[model samples]
Target: VINTQRAELEALRKKESKYKKAQEKVSTNKLLKDEIEHLETELKTFEDKDVEIGSLKLQTEKLSRANKALMNDIKNEQKRYDFLESKYKELLVKYNIAAKDLEKKQ
Candidate 1:
């Protein structure tokens, strides 16, 4: 009877060890699952930010193009103004010559 009890106790101890090992495996799997979920959320946020950055880059390109066009227009207007100023000076010189001729005749 004593030997039989000893064998039964040994079997029960083996089963307990197996149960502990299974519980540890489950706990480790749960931790891994939580880590995966966190990484997924982080990936989604980064993707959204990347899209927003792309949009801003496009807007910056458009603004740069618009600024270049405006600068060209200003240059053209400046050339036109200079041409008009030169023509006015020429007209004044012609008027002065005509006035001198009229004075001599009088």
Candidate 2:
């Protein structure tokens, strides 16, 4: 009877040890799951920011193209003004020469 009681006590101790190990593993698994969830959330936030940055870059590129077109228009207008100014000077010189000839004839 004494040997039987000792055997039963040893078996119970072994079961208790296994249960403690299982509890520790469960808690460790829970901690790992929590960390994974946090990392996933952070990754999603970064992805959203990346998308926003891409949109801003596209807008910047569009603005840059528009500015280049405006600069070209300004350059064309300046060239046109220069051409008109030269023509006006040439006409004035011709008019002055004609005025002098008429005075001499008179």
At residue 8, give the lDDT of candidate 2.
98
lDDT of 2 by residue, 1-106 (tens): 9999999999999999999999999999999999999999999999999999999999999999999999999999999999999999999999999999999999
Number of clashes found in candidate 1: 0
The 0-to-1 C-alpha lDDT of every candidate, in the order given, reads 0.95, 0.98
Q: Which candidate leads in lDDT?
A: 2
Per-model TM-score, in order, reads 0.69, 0.69
lDDT of residue 41 for candidate 1:
96
Candidate 2 whole-model C-alpha lDDT, 0 to 1: 0.98
> Which digits, one per residue and each the tens of the lDDT, describe model 1 over residues 17-101?
9999999999999989999999999999999999999999999999999999999999999999999999999999999999999
